[model samples]
Each structure stands twice: as C-alpha cells, then as structure tokens.
Target chain A: MPETILQTRALSVERGRQSIGLPDLTLHAGGTLALCGPSGSGKTSLLLALAGLVRPRAGEVIIDGQPLWRLPEAGRARLRGRAIGFVFADYRLIDSLSVMDNLQIARASAHLARDLDRATNLLERLGVAPLASIRADRLSQGQMQRVALARALMNRPALLLADEPTAALDEAAGDRLIDLLLDLGRDEGIATVIATHERRLLPRLDDTLFLALPAEAVA
Target chain B: MIRLRFVLQGLLRRWGSTCLTIGVGALSIAGLCLIFWAQSAIPEAVKTRISETDMVVGPKSSGLDLALCCALQMTPAQGLLELERVQARLAMDDVRPFVRMQVPVAMGDSYRGHRIVWTTPDIAPFYGARLTDGRTWRQPLEIVAGSEAARSLKLKPGVRLTSSHGLAADGDAHDAAYTVTGILAPTGGVLDHLLLADLASIARVHDHGGEHDHTETAPHSRVNAVLVRFTSEIAQASLPVLISDSETLSAASPRLELAKLMALARPLIDGATIVSAIFGALAVMILGLSLMQGLNRRARDFMLLRFLGMSRRDLALLSIGESLLITHLALLGGCILAVAGQSVLAGMLASHGLTVSGAVPFREALTLYSAAVVLSVLSALGPTLRMSIARDDEELRA
Candidate 1:
C-alpha cells in the first residue's frame, strides 16, 4: 500500500473577506496534485494553509498521519522546516546569497547542520551546479526557479508545496518545470501540491482540485 | 554561511550610513570615558600633589598665590622673601617647636617652560621623588630633571641647559648654564615636571652674573618661598603665630589652596560630562532608528526568510544579530580611541605641572561597556519586534 503523504478533511480558510471551503483530499507518496482557481479564489490561501504557513479556519490538515494544527505554532513551524518544502512564485531567494548558499539556508532553517555535499548534489541534479556560486539576484527567472526547487529539495522533504512555481517562466521553461516536478514525484517519492492557473499542467498531475469558479472567486 | 554573509552584506548595503553610525557610537563612548576620567582623576592627581605640604611661607601676597607660586610652582613670585627674616620667625620661642622641616625655595627662573625649583636635596624625598638616574645635585648649579620634564626637554645627566629669568619660555635667557646631574622617577604628583636644584644655583644666577662660581656659598641672595611641614597637628594650628610678627611673609595652606583651585575647575568638568552624555544619548537614538529602518527596508526579504522555513523567532534573531555586530565593532573602536585619548590628556596635563597617567578608570570602563551593550540590545528591540510580527504568508490572492 502506498503511504499517504497528505490528507485533509473539511478544510476551510479565510483570505481577505472571502472564506474558502476546500474539498476533501488525499495524496499518496510520489503523487502530484494540481490546485486551479480564479485570481481571487483562495488557491494560494489553501496552499499556505496546507503548508502550515497559515492556519485554516476549519477542519484538520493531516501530513504524514499527524494533525498539523493540533500542535503549537512552533511545532507546526518545526514540522514545516523538517518535513515540508515550499516554493514561492517569485523564487524568494536572498539576493545577496549564491545558489548553493540558498540551499544551505534551507538546511539551517530546518535545524539541520550544513552539508556542502548535499547542497552540491542537489544543485548538480537540478542542472544549475555551474551557477552555484552565482548570486540569486543575477539569475534569470527560469534559473531562479530551478535554484528555488533545489533549495526546497535540500532537506529532502516528504511534501512540496509550490505556489505558481512556473508563472514567471516562458513556455519552454514552464514545460521543463513540469517535467522536473513529475520526475521528482516519480523517482524521489516527493509528494507535490502546486497552485497554478496553467491549464496544460492539470492533465499531467495525478489529481486536480478546483478551489473556486471565476464567478465564485471573491476578494 | 549564507546567513553570516547576509548579516555582513546588510551592513555593506548601506555602507555610508553604517560607517557614520559606527563613528558616532565610537566617539560617544570614548567621550564619555574621557569625561569620567577627567572628573575623577584630575582632582585626585592634584590633591595627591598638594597633600604633603602643610603650608607655603612666601613674600606677603594672597595666600592662594603664595601657595601656587611656592608649593606647586604654578605662578610667578610677587616679591622676594628675605631668607634671614624667614629664618628669624622660625627661631622664635612660639614658632620654634612647631617647625619640623623647611625647604627654602629660591625661584623666579625657568628652563624650556619648566619651573626651575631651587631648594636643598631634601625636596626630592619630600615630594616622594626617587632618583631614576644619576645622583642629586652636590655642587652649586647642578640640577635634576623630573621625569616628564626630562622626556619633554630631553635633559639628561651632564646635559647643560640655560635658564631664563621668568616662569615662561619667553623670558630673558640667562648666561649661566646649569648641568643636569640626575633624573627623578615619576611620583604621579607635581614633582614630575620640575627642574630641581640647590638654593645656591638661584643665588649665583642673581648675584651679578656669577657664571664661573660653582661654589655652594654664593651668599643668601633671596628666598622666594619656604615649604614648611608641621611637626604636629598643633604645629599646623600655630601658622598664624608664625606669620603674625613677620611683615614680609604670609603662610598659605596647601590643602585649602588646592581645593579652591579644583573648585574653579569643576564647572569645566561638569560641562564636558553633560555634553558627552548628550552625544551618547543621540548616538543611541541614531543607532536604534538606523537598525529599525534597515529592518523595514528589508522587510520583504525577512518575510521571504520566514516563508523559507525560518521561524519568526529566528528572523528576529537575525535582525538583532546585525545590530550586535555593528555595536561590537563600535565598542572595540571606542576602547582604542578612549585609551589613546587618556594618554594624550595625561601628557597635556603633565606639561601644566599635574601628573596624570594613562590609567583607565576600570570601574567606569566596566560600567560604560555594560551600558553600551545594554543600549545596543535596547536599540535592537525595535527591529526584533518588527521582524517577529512580520507576516510571511503574504499571498492573499489565488
């Protein structure tokens, strides 16, 4: 039996004045799920809430069979650092740091000791090993996204939550990101839930969840 | 490694402001340290100098002037005191028993801005000065240089220096040359800046150009002052009786005169302390404001850090760590500057006949160091709080 990496029941979140009620979901290890909705539909809110970055207004979010919000905020943060990885749309890299440095920061955030070999290995696998010494601020958007993915995978987390990870990239870069996510799922058994408006990505994912219709989306 | 790099780069990002803030902090701490040193050490140095002599008997003038001219050699003699007349008063039945030791000083001359204090060899031990090099003046016209005076004027044993007729360097130079016979070690008192010699040197210089007269018997030409030590407490009380009959002499209390002199200097000391305190307060405010604004400028980056699995507490610590780095650097600079400043101030004071050394007020330094660190932490508090409350779950839209 495949181990369920992510499970949610009756999950709801407040984004601005809109309260979003999400569908029940289950994602097994090495599975990929897509979250699609309109601009103000709280897809990003659900991603944050599921990643334990924000608290849900209702229901339980279970990651690896443990209730996420039942523990204290510190515990949730620790779990987020150790067991989960998040990729932001803008890459969220400290501009002054190099690509390898960004990966090392992830290790520190996870309360893990530095492993230069692990960082080097992750960057090499992402095909940005030559750019490891290059500063994040100088990288192209596609390169930054690759580096961000490498940083997210630095701790080898069980779950990866990405919010529009390919939104800023060109079509070819977007397609490449999709391939990376799928390969990571297939080979590394890293479960992924991506919030994106990309229509082509939906068919590639193992499952899809619609957070809100265009008319249902509210500020 | 990246966190450390960022902490350092954050400082470099605003290099101009960072340098300025560090300079201000250093100046403030150094200034406050100096104020503490000046407030306590100057008066202490002066009191230690004047505590040995009970009274200064000089030609009738203001008691303060007589004490200044005689005991401290800080002022010019108004008139000469007859040696015979000064001795006659000590031989009196009433004043005889009260007199313990008297070093009659024949002044009214100087060499290279240092006072030429001509008395017997006993003045060296009287002022707690020991010979660091060579022996005391045995024959007339031989002299000993105080430690600082030797350093400044470069006078050593066997070096002959010409004396001028007055207390300052601009006075008329005399033809008689006095040979430096010895150098006194530092006494941390008034003795470290004087040129001491026997009374016959002054007598020879004044008695019709006695240049070749190395004799100790050049006649009792003059006595400008007599530094008297009382035999007992009752002897100090008999100062009035000793000077009552004498029409040409006045007794000045060294302790009383020194207190008045320091009292006059109190205002300057207090003003310096206040100005330094104001600067210190201003520096703290600038540091606090700068740290807070720097954090705010990087608010998005901090939020990004939070999203990257860093806890809010960790984010706050990063901000505080930056402030602490700046403060610790400033503290090191301030200490170096303060010690250098103390040494310079001591040199300047020594030239004016008060001996101050480059000794740090340890208690004051420890207190100021603690206060500086505490103030830096307080300054960091604003940025810490701001970082702690910053929301990293920034995306509200889908």
Candidate 2:
C-alpha cells in the first residue's frame, strides 16, 4: 500500500553458469531489508540484479513499479542512475580528488545539476564539512566511510544497494553508519537492501532474506 | 554526463607514471619530427641552391668544397681567381659559344658568423633574391641582410653591425661599421642567409683602394668563385675538365657534386630512419605499458564508478578519455620541444657547412599527430575494455 520500491517474484540471479533462485519478496517505501548469507552465497549478485546492473536469469525484478531489464540499455542505465545508489565496504572514493569532488562526480553520473547546498547540508550532517577539502585518500577509514555514505545519498535515490557498507569501520562507527542509513531511508522514503553478515544490525531492518550457501559454494 | 575533470582527476591520481609516459612521448615525437624535417629539407635546400647554376668555377680546389663554398656559401674561399682573366679564357674560339652568363662572387669577411658576399647588384637577380626592406647597397660600407640573417642578427634598415675578417665568428672585428641598407626576402635557398654587398665593399674591406675596382662590372679584381651557366649539356659534360686543365682555375658541376654528397649521407639517413622507427615503437610501448601497469588500480576505480550508477558508455568514455588527455598533453610538449630542437639542429648543421630552411612542415606534423592519436587509441583499447567490464562481484573484488 505504501508503494513497493523494490520487489522480486521468483527471481533467480545469473552467476556465471549457475543460477540461484530467490524467494518472492517486496519492500515498500522507507523500508530496509537485510540479505544475510555466507561468503559467495550470491548476496552481492542478488543486489546487482535488483539494481539492474546484471540480468536476472528468471522471474521478474521491479524497482519503483517499473520492470527492470525490460527497458532498453540506455533507459535502464538512466533509471539506475536516477533511482538507485550503491555503497561499498571498502569506501571506494577516487583518492586524488577532494571529498566535495567525489560527491560532485556522483551527481554528475546521474546527469544532475551540482546542488551545492544539498551537498553541503549532507556533508554537515555526516560531520564531514571540515573534511570536504581533504583528499579522499588522506582521510581516516571512519571519515572515508562517512564521506562515501554522503556520496551514495548525493543523488537522493529511491532504492539503496549496499555491499557490507560498514564492514571496514569499528563497531561503534558501524553502528553510527547503520543508524544514519536507516534514519535517512525513513526520512527520505528510500528503500535500502544491505548485503551483510553482521547480526546486531538485523533487528533494526524491516525484513531479512537469508540466502543459504549452495553445496558447491561451501567448500 | 561524466565530466572530463573526473577523467583527468583519475589521471592525476597517478601523476608520476602519467608524466613519465608523456615525457617519453614528447621526446619521441620531437625526434621523429626533426628526422623527417632534416631528411626532406637538406636535399631540398641543396637542390634549390644549385637549380640554375650549372658549374662552379673557383681556384683549383675540391669539387665538394667548391660546390659547398661557392653555391651554398658554406665556407670561405681557399683562393681567388682573376675575374678578367677567366672571362678572357671563356672568350676562346670553341668555348665562347657554349658559355652563357657569368656571375662573380668575392667572399672573405663576415658579420656575426654570416657570410659576406662582395659581388655586383647583378648577383641579386641571379639568385632570385628580392629586397624586402631598404634598397641595395650603393656604397662600400652598405650591405643587405638576407631574410634569416636579418631576423637572427636583428638587423633592420638603420642597424649597423661590424663585419669580421674571416668566415668564423672568432675572426678579427672590422673597424668599418657596415650599415644594413636592405633586407632580402626569403628565397628558401642559400641566398636567404647570405649578406649581399657590392664589389667596392670587398675592395674597401680588403683595403684594395684602386677606385676603378669598386665598379659593379668587370672590375679587374680577383673573385673567389664564378658561377657559370652553360648553353648546352655537352658543355656541362666537358667544360669542368677543360677549366680544371689550367693551373689556377677549377670547375665543378653543382648538380654532380651535390649528388655525391647525398649519396655519401644516404647510409646515415637510413640509419636514422631505422632508429626513429625503433624509438617511436618504444615510446608507444611505454605509453601502453604505463596504462597497463595501472590497470588494477584503475579498474577498481572504474568499478566504483560503475557501481555509482555511471552508465557503461560513460565508463568506457571515462577510460578512453584518460589516455587521450595524456596524449594531448604529450602533443603540446612535443611540439614545443620540436620547434626548439630544430633551430638548435639548424645551427649545428650550419657550423659544419650546411643550411636549413626555417619553415614549419604543417602537413607532415598533422600526419604525425593523427598517427600518434591512432596509436594512442590502439594502445588504450585493452585497458579501456577491461575498465568497463570490471565488476565487484565477478572479476575485480571476488
């Protein structure tokens, strides 16, 4: 009723020669979901499929009421750029550029105008306003993780795909990032799907999809 | 929609390798340009200098030296030949019909390392030299600077520079302050660099103060060389031997001696061509390897970009654009180096009896630029492809 932001019906992600079938699931606006799995359990792959980055082998993926992979390549790319955001565990920021430029690149990738006020507000919220002029490579790991989170939210996407976004941070820092992510998702009506193994953060999310490791992936 | 700044930022992220590749590329491009320029220009300058003159008649001397000294104005004359006596000898029964025009040149003094040719004003039209500035020299102390000579020596119509005693720059400075009365337009030949003066100028410089010897016509003065035009090919074949039979006069065909000179330099030219090809290949390899060496880091960056919702095409463009920026930077540096290097090369060659035209080879440069770009694209193809295809879940991270 709140309008599904991310939905999958019998979706199976194509992982090279193998395909892993997924259960039917739906997440409404402002909701968060956890994808719990061991290493190589296709969590990252499922996130990729849901974000329209990779083709699903079967069934359907719907983001914001539009069928993913049914649109033309450019249209799909446009949708992904405008409607999706991604975060990395390693905080992938171009090391040479300043923190502000990293956010500008995110806005540029979506063909969006440089909203300086919005970027400044986000950096201030992340407590990184003083670090905006610093190069990404010079930042501490916690600072880098915050700056990366700011870049992810730069485009104000409808859905967020994060691959262990807080894996590299300390427990307290990770807790702070998870709190900021869930609070921002609720305030902005953004649906978030996180691929992570940390159990402490699962209770804060609205739903969880536990992907059991296939036999071939265990050993 | 990904900005070029982002593309360039990624390049500067690895500035050390970027600068190295560009440095090598610039040097290679400059070397290639110089080789091509010298290969084409030297023979061209020689051919144009000897285009009209059939034979060089000077005092008994080496044909190579005579051609280089008399026609190209490369060196000072070894000895002087009597002009009146040579004309008298040409007026013989069988030789008079074969002879055409005769222009005498007396060379000895120099100004700022530039040769001073003391001949009549008739020598101006003979070498196709036209005045671009003030009039031809009317008095012994007045002189006309060639186009290059004026530019290099900074001579204008009113500028006064002293001439030296010999062709070398170290010669005794003359007390006579020579006035630059005119400047010659560029002929792209030897005349573009020579200082043309009248016979009286040499007579004054040599202190041969007979006043009659100051005239522009047959002044009964000895000249360093006589440029001869023959009416028929038969004379060209037999006249140099006939003239050389005399004890004091020697004849050398300008075309024949220049051929021998080129044939002698052919091996060096071939060797330069081979070395340039190798250097060019190596430069391209360094460029490719520079890109290849950074692939892992660049691929990770590109993976981040792709994940950040940058489209596949934008990702590919970002990758290719990175290499193109390096290439464009190299081109700018190479062009500056080539321009500076060519002038230095010209000066070095001039020191040893050769002259080069100062003209930009625009078409050849354009060809080289296009070739360089094509090579750059080819060299970057694999890396760009790898960047676009990089993935966190598949190839790169996993």
| Interface RMSD of each candidate, angstroms, one decimal | 1.7, 2.1
Instruction: Please identify model 1 stretches exceeding 4 Å from their true place.
Output: A206-219, B75-78, B90-98, B110-114, B128-135, B145-173, B179-186, B207-221, B232-247, B394-398
**Per-residue lDDT tens digits of candidate 2, residues B1-398?**
33777666656767788888788888878777887788788778678877778888888899888988888777657777788878887888767788777788888778878888888887777777799889999988888988988888888998888887777888777667788899999877778778888887764565535532322223328888888888897887788888888888888898888898889988998887678667667767877777776666666776666666667777666656767778888888887888898889887877754677655478887888898888888778877677566554664364
For residue B92, model 2's alpha carbon misses the true position, in angstroms, by 4.2
Per residue, candidate 2 scores C-alpha lDDT tens digits across A1-219 of 677888888888866677888778888888787887667777778888887777788889888889988986667777887889888888889887889989988888777888888889989998999998898999999899889888988889899888898899889999999988888888888888888878777776755443443523421
DockQ for model 2 equals 0.51
Which candidate leads the pack in DockQ?
1
Reference-based lDDT, residue B225, model 1: 74
Question: Evaluated with lDDT, which candidate comes out highest?
Answer: 2
Error of 1 at B222 (Å): 2.1
What tens digits encode model 1's per-residue C-alpha lDDT throughout B1-398? 66888788778887777887788888888888888887778768767777778888877788788777777766667667677788778777877787777778866678979988788888976776799999999987899999989999998899999998777789778777899999999876777888988887766676665454322222445677778887786665558445844677788777776677778988987888788778778778888888877776667667666656777778777877887888888888887898899989987876667776545578988888888878888888888876666455552221
- Candidate 1 at B225: error in angstroms? 1.7
Winning model by TM-score: 1
